[model samples]
Target: MSDPVDFRDNRGVGTLISDLIQQVSSLMQTEIRLLRAEMGDKLKTMLGGAVEVLAGGLLLMAALLILLQALVVALAHWVGAGWASLIVGLVVAVIGVILVKRGTSNIEPSNLTPDQTTNQLARDAAVVKEQFK
Candidate 1:
């Protein structure tokens, strides 16, 4: 990545303008590359979170199945066993829901936005404009 142009020489006006354009173009390209890299990193993180959500969903489904099957069978035999099974299933379901929520937040639009890269570009633009003044 190239630094912003520092035009302090007694160069021709046209040459200076051309150099400035080139430097600005280089800066833009560099920022774009950085943005792409940042986006890629976010996507990978989101994907990992998505996997967690999927696993959580599976756990949720299993917990529900456990609750249904256990309650139906255990209730016929003993009230105490049925209550214990229900408690265990509810605990598992709660854990699954928490996992899903955490994973969902990881993929949220707020989390995915390339705020750092955007801010960096803005700072670079301000510096270049300052030099212009």
Candidate 2:
């Protein structure tokens, strides 16, 4: 079991409070810097995903165009060329409309929230409250 805290001290309460305030102020600055760093990391990760998604989208677009063109040509031989072009165009449009969604899923603003800093701040607040009592 933990020993009980001894509140009696040679230092005055006023001095203790002043030191606590200074420490809390310094902690706040550190937390802010940590928040900034965490946010930067999230941004970098998001940008990397975006770049990969963009590259994949471009490659997929090219492949889809080729495959769909071939399909259209094959379909044109069976049905009319006009109908085949229309059908292939509709399919391509639908695929493109939903294409970037998966890649951009990581880029949400909520993901930038500094979870570590928030948790640390909560812990700091709890400690400060305990110290006051």
Candidate 3:
């Protein structure tokens, strides 16, 4: 029976180092891809929040104009025209503030961060550190 030759005996330190470098390079590329994907998802979420804020602002503006006029006309009998208009304006402004606040909450720093990628990279670094030790 023929015996198989062992390849490990022929492998030098330089070859091992080269293989290590290649592995690290591949790992970095994969991490970068993951980072990009995570960032893209966060960006999409941010974009959705921004769109919601914009839509809310537009709706608020429309409501301010139309509802203000309607409310002012409706309540003008109970209060004077000017007081009714002022009250309506204040109410619409408050609602607009609430909508804006809700939309902006979704775009906070925490929500916009690539949390998964950050955690993954930290874990990877810890693993590499442990391996080196």
lDDT per prediction?
0.90, 0.76, 0.79
Better of 1 and 2 by lDDT: 1
Predicted structure with the largest lDDT when compared to the true one: 1
lDDT of 1 by residue, 37-114 (tens): 999999998998898899899989989988997789686987677778888899889999998998998989888999
Candidate 3 has an lDDT of 0.79
lDDT of 2 at 132: 78
Predicted structure 1: lDDT: 0.90
> Model 3: per-residue lDDT, tens digit, 1-133?
8698566667788997788788788989998999899889988878877877887797689667866686767676665775666667767777777777778987888997888888888998997787575
Cα error, residue 36 of model 3, in Å, equals: 0.5
- Per residue, candidate 2 scores C-alpha lDDT tens digits across 58-85 of 7567657756776767666865664565
Candidate 2 vs candidate 3: the TM-score winner is 3
Maximum-TM-score candidate: 1
Candidate 1 stretches greater than 4 Å from native: 1-8, 79-84
Q: Candidate 2 versus the native: TM-score?
A: 0.69
- Candidate 3 Cα errors over 4 Å, as ranges: 1-10, 76-99
Write down the TM-score for model 3.
0.71
All-Cα superposition RMSD per candidate: 5.0, 5.2, 6.8
